[model samples]
Target: MKPRLHSQLDVNGEAFAANREQLLAQLATVEAVGRHQQTSAETKREKYAQRGMLLPRERLSLLLDPGSPFVEIGALAGYKMYDDKDGSGAGGGCIAGIGFIEGVACMVRVDNYAIKGGTISPAGMEKALRLQTIALENKLPFVTLAQSGGANLLYANEIFAPGGRGFANQARMSAAGIPQITVVHGSATAGGAYQPALSDYVVLIKNQATMYLAGPPLLKAATGEIATDEALGGSDIHASAGTGDYVADDDAQGIAMARAIVSSLNWSSLLADIKQDIPAPSYSPEELVGVIPANTKTPFDAREVIARLVDKSEFLEFKAGFDNQTLCGHGQLYGEPVGIITNNGPITAQGANKAAQFIQLCEQSGTPLLFLHNTTGFMVGTHAEQSGIIKHGAKMIQAVANATVPKISIVMGGSYGAGNYAMCGRGFDPRFIFAWPNSRTAVMGGAQAGKVLRIVTEAKMGAASDAAMLEKLESDTAAFVDDASTALACTARLWDDGIIDPRHTRDLLGLLFHLCKHADKVTTRTNQFGVARL
Candidate 1:
């Protein structure tokens, strides 16, 4: 395969400079939100120190191998929900990432007990379930630094039913030959006790860890039996009564024990050694900041972005001239073979058929598929409608939905309408989906939606409304849709993993592809049923 030619891209032009500046501004907004959440956690640092407890992040730092990268997920999960003042309560009361522990990749989750006692919000529940799903799919060992107050009772109705699935996933993972190591850093009471109980290994922090179905207050109220915290479900009792596998002196010791447990699992033995002699792209990664237009309306070749991401800037364009709007090609990221599908414009019937054929080829070869979303959607109007777009568009969607290989999506710009579905949006369950800070996702463009609604309203009213009222309706609808489709709004609801900086796109994709490759080599021993406690 020859190295791609992105000579057509004007990397040094004024438009590129403007785009870079705009991307930076958007990146700053997303990063600032993450920092705010961290600051919120920091507010309790002094209090935690007074109690001889480590902050959640401090524990996480010690848990991961020193100098290893931690790719944090859902950093802005709950930006402004449930008593979160000043938009500081991000991450939904948890810190989670894929990081190395004793040189083994593990999914590490820490309950940010500093914030609202690490109560699980609706978003927090969603994050927890998603993390479990990732660990299951990637065959990564699961490790959690537990200190949560359990599901927020205020939103119990919202969380109660779905929350049970988290425990179910843990149970199934254990039975599927996946190891789970949990460190009880603080309170893991009530429903939280199931987390450690279901784990293959549990480490309790002496004098600090608590794990019980019901705490002292609830025990007292229900049974009229007053008891101390330790008596009901203390570290001593759990360790002596078989509820905990190991007991540690404090948070540091507990984390050390968890790392040791992971090291002992022989998890590395299951993975085949993969040599990654990947070459850097011919283009500088810094140029990525400018490749994407500041405005969604402007168009740029997706190849320009791909040039800076793939190894050696090499790409074998599948059918370059057949359907230019839909770009599909074969490339290597970190020396791992992958099929790339990116949109340059709306998906015409030809484009849809092109992508459908590309997806099938990738699936047949067992290559992972990467979707770079930037389409308004499938083409519309008379010509597009007559072109059998609906027929071929459905074919593309079917290919995306049913691809056997790992599928990942990155919402780079306008991800609207059926284009989002065909391009492997969150709805299609791509193995992982991420969005750039400048990304926008909606059923349709805001202005288009407003116009559609206005037209329908005028027809129903059967009369021309006052100019001022019609104007207000159109303006209000457009404003609402625009706000709703913003990257921040999508991220707060966990639409994608996290709004990532454009410059880091290559690094993230490489990491993900590496993980998926490792997962492909792993084979899990399975049972008909998950393990259950007596």
Candidate 2:
């Protein structure tokens, strides 16, 4: 007689996989009918939904390409069998491996809570390491949804050490060449955030996930520090503090955003040198008269201007929420590629820092840059300083200065102070500079100057003592301070290249770029030969 075969061992192998698939399909049919139970299930599902967490199979359906091949690593990782006879299910912490995103193979991990609290088991940890390593070796991107209770709380003292697999894998992820993306879907309090930190980019769903270097329970008891997860690391903390790059409202949105971001990338090195188009500057922007607003102080969406100026609907925005003051992204000019930096016309420190990065990315990509300047100035007061504006503000200046791309500046209004310098001021070396006819430029506006003089005069001689003396001071001071105006005085010496009609902006920019393409300075540059030299 043939040797006795165990049912759990997939004794028939290939035939067993075929039988399992057929059985799963049948089970899915039953689930489609009346299998889902009681009214309380909705409440349970809602609880998970509120945390932006979804069932593993549902998440898999949302992530993978239709009918694409997927190889699951650590398929039977965490066997919670009381004995080998009880090993009916497995895969602890997560199911990870190679799958396709938009039909392109990619590295991905899906947290599975069926086996454990999504805590990394020895087998699961090996799988995660394998997937991450595979992503780097193949040069594909990595994406993982982490929702573990952490450290297999049941593992006890063995995993409790300071130097273990957790620390080792984090260092590996950091040095790996592939781009890694992660979303925090559950507790994520222990090593979860560090994993994403090791990755190139991180996305946190709002108010649902918590991230920490060391968990709160351990911290409070170990040290006297009383801190909640949000104070340690939450959406608000990460976004506002620049610790996290993207924040999504839910898991679906986070995944969608990642999909969009991944699709936009060229899957190459340094995160630059790729271009996305914007609506070309075709429609007469006189249409935007209502769009931009008469009162420059009134905020109008800069994306509208971007929409009108780029090739229809090609303005791909990045880091949109981090800095509300400026709008930055990449788009094509006519058919040629260029980067855009427009002041959202909001005065905020976050906006300034982004404006700086936009400048730098443009230079690195060898792509040209266009600035639509309508800045009032920096956010003011002690509240602003507390936001680290000064530190980021200075960094913005350096980024702008170091940018070597062919930059064109189009001043909208009030491009003043360091705002002007940061937003392609003549000092920043833009290739061509133009302002709309309605714009008023200055280092500091004339009103601010007048106010300063008034304060000084009032201090020197009381307001009661002012008559002819105040009148002379007013006339003389106004004329001298008119030096701040962005007029013939500013443009006569090539400080600006004169104003242009918005309707012709596309053609004008395209022509300028083509000219600059053949410009004497660019042809001799190393960036022209590509990043290989660097």
Work out the TM-score per prediction: 0.97, 0.43
Candidate 2 per-residue lDDT over residues 353-385, each given as its tens digit: 777777777777798888888876677788889
C-alpha lDDT of all candidate models, in order: 0.87, 0.60
- The C-alpha stretches of model 1 lying farther than 4 A from their native spots are 269-276, 528-534
Residue-wise C-alpha lDDT for candidate 1, range 1-534, written one tens digit per residue: 765756477887999999999999999988888787778788889988987899888998999888876788888887777666677778888999789988888898999898889998999999999899889999999999999999889899999998999988887898888888899988888789999999889899999998888888899889999888888889999888888989999889889999899888777632234445668898988888898887768898888888888988999998888988999999988788989999899999999999999999998889999999999999999999999999999999999999989999999888999999999998898889999999999999789888888888877777656667777788899999999899998888888888888888888888888888888787777775654444
For candidate 2, the 10 contiguous residues with the lowest summed lDDT are 525-534
Q: How many Å off is the CA of 411 in candidate 1?
A: 1.1
What TM-score, to 2 decimals, does candidate 2 have?
0.43
Most accurate candidate by lDDT: 1
TM accuracy, model 1: 0.97
